[model samples]
Target: MKASLLSAAILATAIVSVTACKKDKSTPNYAKADDFMASHAIKEQSFSGNAAAGFTITGKDGTKVTFSPNAFVDGNGNVVSGNVTVTLKEVLSKKDVLFSGVMTESNGQLLESGGEILVKAQKDGADLRINPALQNDGARVEIPKAMNKKDMGLFVQDKRQQGGATGGNQPQQSPYTWNPAPYYPFGNGPNSYSFSLPSFTWVNCDRFYSDPNPKTTITALPAFQDNNQVTDLQVMLVFKNITTVITLPYDFTVQKFQSYQNSLPIGLQADLIIIGKDSDGYIQFGTQPITISANMHIDAPIHKATQAEVDAFLATI
Candidate 1:
């Protein structure tokens, strides 16, 4: 009888110990709330100076203008520069796609805004949570309030064009007086005309062209010419349809040129290659070369003849 009583007492003690340990291991509701508050705490992030200038765009004949800004508030309540691109997938269906603007720091790091901001915690390491709401046009757009980053959308304004002024500028007339000069060096003849080539300020050789459509106002650099001193030259061409800029690099070969052409659409192909000399005295390629395709709708004076024509022209140079 005494052995039975002792065994019962031992079992009761074990049960109590297990219960206490379980209670100690569980997280309390209050502690969870405190953790959440600590992680989302943000300081002053404001835009006290002039807001960045808005962009202007003209729509198609029957289309309307639409614009929006991607915004985000930092820990100090400061607004960072970023893009908010709104793609009009379908107007009739009211379907649209919105992408947050990505911002790069001076250190070359990239950050994305909008939705949930990634947050850091003392115990949890890194986490994501919804950001706070932003005021826009007398309404609020709810955003995740985490420490990561946030992006907001801005309102757009539009105006209609009228009268002869239209919304665009008028064409300007050339100031040079007409003079007949020899075109070919066949001595002086009445039919000979000395045409003045357009002049352009040489920006950075690596600068990309910025145009969605072809224009007589802008012309890409010329192609590379091979000489006996240089064995080979390679050029790289990058083209974007949305921006409509064709960037050409100085160093590219026939194979690289073919690769670039293959990557583009059937109608959007590069027209020229730009080349220069490297530090080793060998002819190097340009950093950015404009892509000119023959399929463009704009009737720009710039022309990219066939490969045979290009070779013939290079031979002359």
Candidate 2:
């Protein structure tokens, strides 16, 4: 009887010890980690989050077609939630449209979900179409033709004429003679004018040319530094009378936001540059990166350019 009682006591203690150990063990929260991984993986695939989100579709001719989020449909005929932007080379007079958007499951299975679609002929041009099975084929809708050279040239000339005047009217004979001292961002005095220095230059070939073998060039400028970090830089370029190349000078490094979202082992990088001359003269302009965080939106350096100054600079090119 004593042996039996001792054995029971020993078994009860063992059960309690096992329960305590289990309580001490940390339960793995796979959900949170999975969520982070998923978000990061999709970051690179996300659109630039610009007002426009779509691909440009170019045809054999120079035409292109642009499609918005409203142009797709899922297998069940449900409209997709996300926006899709497409640019086509030229408008099609008549053609069949077949496209699809699908979501892949964790198990490597594809499921057709919500999407938008159109199927009709209007006086404007071709009809819009969507299909579930089409996703397997990897085909996209067609695009419209790009603007002709004459039209593009006219547009550029109009921009130059709108500016106050050209170098012909200026007293200075050199284009670089525009008082570089006053243009520096940290000039002293109440009436001092300052502007950010150009960061890069992009050159692109004119699309109007018959030859499609246009080459582009991009030149990168020194990065502006502040508090040990790159502060501001401007990229400028001209596009005119060239063939097919488009150049952009930019640090295409994977953005921090993208890195966090995509969970990429390493980020991506690219740059663009273009240069051209219009009927008025050479045209130069490029985009600059602007960071707006929760604490600050407009950095002091970016705000250095007054509206009048920007307009004047735009006019000169």
Candidate 3:
């Protein structure tokens, strides 16, 4: 058995080496990236200290895989530490799939969103099979019934667009745009505010892993608010028609996590309710729907009015 395993490793190394040496740019081979991940399957990784401070592992093909601290958050919002085995079903080039988002649950179970292909991973006794929800949306969808679980992770990108209005495979626009118009109104004036159709933001834990280095921070998008006053910010995401709500930290503020929102995949949407008591002690309510695809500025003003007016404005949202 030992000899056979050694021989298998040698043969696998040779196959990946050949796959990497291919010189054709027009039809570059991805079998090597796929193969390397298969041979080096990580059953469980152990981390100490801040597990939320994620780490990156570099594959033999130089692919850097990073995981956000939230990726390991349990259902109760606690960061997972200790020995956790995450299997890669398959590793393909960025050009292979349309949309792919991988998230691990509290028990370290893997969930794949978008993309027709399904990779199977096992946790405890249940079979983590391919989901049909991601297959319903786009044109020219191809759902592979099964995939190799140990190499399931595609190292190229987290989000991708195959064919769309822009024509061929192209990256989508920035998730958040910098605009200072929080007071901008929607339709008419003080009471009637216009709103985009509601979409939920995914913000249970704002931490993200864009790179392998723990010290590397996200600095692209700007801050939303300066002071941290409002807490209990929450966002939701829908997959396969199932709604999943994610909550942000109690001290979360617009300014602290606007940039984090900017890093989310384009096309994800969110909704927010603005309610409070006025100086006169009367309760006021306001709401706005936020889209994270191309625009980031919240121009709609929250109307502080009667319950009826608030309900009307919320109807538009």
Question: Candidate 2: misplaced stretches above 4 Å?
Answer: 1-72, 78-218, 223-234, 242-247, 250-303, 315-317
- Report, for all candidates in order, the number of backbone clashes: 34, 68, 22
Cα lDDT of model 2 by residue, 1-317, tens digit: 99999999999999999999998885532222223223323111111111123333433442222334333444455433343432321111111101011111111111111111221211113222333333322222221222222211100001122212221221111111111122222212232111221111111111122322322212244322222222222222222222111111242452111111111111111222211222222222233432212221111122222234434433432
lDDT tens per residue, model 3, 1-317:
99999999999999987777774334422122223223434333222223335444433322223443423433343445543333332222221211122221111111232211222222332332212222211111111212111212211122223232223322222222111122321222132112211111111111122322222111112222222232222221222211222222121333322222223444444454433343433333334555444534433333234444543543442
Tell me the whole-model lDDT of each prediction, alpha carbons only: 0.24, 0.24, 0.28
What lDDT, from 0 to 1, does candidate 2 have? 0.24
Of 1 and 3, the candidate ranking higher by TM-score:
3
> What 10-residue stretch in candidate 2 is worst by lDDT?
97-106
| TM-score of model number 2 | 0.22
- Worst window of 10 by summed lDDT in candidate 1: 91-100
Tens digits of per-residue lDDT for model 1, 1-317: 99999999999999999999999988422212223223423221211111123222222211112112322334444443343221111111000001111111101111121111111111112221112232221111122222112222211111212311122332221121111112312111132211111111100001112234433222233333433233233222323232112222221332122221211343343333443333334333333324444422221122212334333433321
Displacement of the residue 146 alpha carbon in candidate 1, Å: 39
Top model by lDDT, which number? 3
